[model samples]
Target: MGTFRDAMSYPLLRVGLIMLILALLISIAGFYRVNKTYSASGTLGEGMHYLGDDKFENEYLYHNRTLVLYSSNANLSLLQGAEMTNYTLVDREITLHPEERPVIYVFNGSVNYTYNATAVDYPYAVYSLFAFVLMLVGVVMAFLGYTQFLRDVKEGKK
Candidate 1:
């Protein structure tokens, strides 16, 4: 149809297609990086972002120049302004309990702290979520552009 033909030249449709491609690339890269785990061993000083009530909920740690999250049910009072020496950080999947969900483990030469994810993989989930949103926006934009172009063609404007 002439309407469909005219719609092919819609500028917004082209922009939406480009965004869709970019979103796909981002999602693929995010997935690849999120699955990969890592480990590090060093001395960590102090904990930030403490979320707990009586019992320990979660906290952020700076390990090896990377910000990571460590969580536990018990009150890890030692993490407050205390330097954790000879600490070993192990990512999920290769942890002692491989069957459990994705998480990171921190062994402070004495106590063990479990984290939701590693610094390398944690932020990728947010990136992937953003990519998904981009994909949705692209789809909507492409559809709107095509329809608008078709409407213009119907009115003999194209």
Candidate 2:
């Protein structure tokens, strides 16, 4: 296709593709990492997303320099550290046991170490980060190419 062929000519397009793949990988790794660290093994059913709707059916991945998962059960509260620490309940929801009060705890830790992903999919943060970087690169490359093309044209006239 002409569109596809045209896209391949630009280095920005290539970089964009690479960034896309990297973002996906990071998201997967983030989910896996969250699952591993999270004792709440209960299937979130349709993963996690910013908008807790069908449109956002995906795995939940903690983000930020630090994450906090609220829970009272000693095991659930502890992620990296075992010692009992002060935790506050941010939110609550339904679980397997109806009678069981939804537990919550502050799971504070570095996302980098906690998540198995290069960049935890914290709100699709990974994709956004890479996309921004790719955009910056693309701008620079376009400017360079345009300037060079203009220079070449001027030289030919002389």
Residue range 1-158, candidate 2, lDDT tens digits? 13444444556555555555655565555333322122212221111212112222224333222232323222223222243334333343212211111222324421111111112334445555665565566566656644544554567621
TM-score of 2: 0.26
Model 1: lDDT of residue 132? 90
Clashing pairs in 1: none
lDDT of 1 by residue, 1-158 (tens): 46455666888887788789989998877654323323433332344322222111122222222223332322223243333222233331112322112222333322333333232334455588889999999998898887888788788888
Tell me how far the alpha carbon of residue 142 in candidate 2 is from the true structure, in angstroms, after superposition.
1.0
lDDT of each candidate versus the true structure: 0.48, 0.36
Backbone clashes per model, in order?
0, 11
Predicted model with the maximum TM-score: 1
Candidate 2 segments exceeding 4 Å error: 1-123
